[model samples]
Target: MPHPCALDPEQVVEHEYVGLLDPELRERIELWEEELLDAEDASAGPGNYDSYEEYEAAMGGGGPEGDELTYQHDLSIAPGWKVGGFASRHLTDPAPVVCSCGAGMRPLLTVHGREWDSGTLNWVPLEDLDVLRLPGANVPAGVYLGRGLMCVFVCPADPAHPHRLSFQ
Candidate 1:
């Protein structure tokens, strides 16, 4: 499926590499990636795609109805980590109602389990399996929000102000 929020083909978006992460955090993220890959692979059953194109064709739906997607407020996953989307899971801690700068906080981005899930079938990196499985085994943060999402909030007064983490 076409990404509902995809921009026009001629639109230009710039992205800069965020500096390399600390060794410890980098290792942790690598481990999480490995876990996610394993889960996705295991969910693909016994069959295997011989090439990336085959997998893409089988998992996505950018066929003839590319423009059929309608914009809605509550989608399952937040595409491109965009802001304004609601948290997928229920909140674990809703604190930080106010930022340290004494200003209201706004959602900065949504940390998703997998880049894509079954509903969207937009771009499943690895067979688009059920990545949102139980939060067992080596969870990324030792915090399990089920298949839920984590919303990061930033201070309106100062972007540098410490951010907050709220799980849904």
Candidate 2:
């Protein structure tokens, strides 16, 4: 079926930054990634921790510090190509993508240029682990949109409503 609204191509404004060079922020991100990987590992195998409390006890008993909201946001949004999931706020703070019809929009599609990066290795499929060392393996599709992702949001109130696009 054809989409209800026509999308016009427009130039996207770019912002400059020093990249993820902040030592403290970088450390937090790295720690979060490690924790994710560890949690995945613990849950995947048999005879591992039976509960979150046990897992926390096994590892040191402390949650993320300094910018807890960002850590929680990262956990809420799944990386890579996804449909019908929470939009990632990696580049910007959480904001609602509202429709002109006064309805809240939800993420309909999220396109990612790379399946996994240095900090998101846990997202890689187990079968693809063998090719981790291969160049371009992480980015099967060479579609790079702005910083890395482009999300499309649609209003639940009406499918015919215009979809909103966000880049991060």
Best by lDDT: 2
Alpha-carbon runs more than 4 Å astray in model 2: 1-74
- The positional error of residue 137 in candidate 2, measured at the CA in angstroms, is 1.2
Which lDDT value does model 1 have at 6? 25
lDDT of 1 at 139: 26
Model 1 scores a TM of 0.34
Among the numbered candidates, top TM-score falls to 2
User: Tens digits of per-residue lDDT for model 1 on 83-122?
Assistant: 5544333333324357876797777776554443333433
List of clashing residue pairs for candidate 1: 1-61, 89-168, 90-168
**How far in Å is the alpha carbon of 162 misplaced in model 2?**
0.2
Candidate 2 residue-wise lDDT, 1-168, digit = tens: 212322222222212122324677667666877787667557445647778877665454424321122343333455666677677777886677899999989889888877666454545556678988698776766667889999999999999999999999
Whole-model lDDT, model 2: 0.65
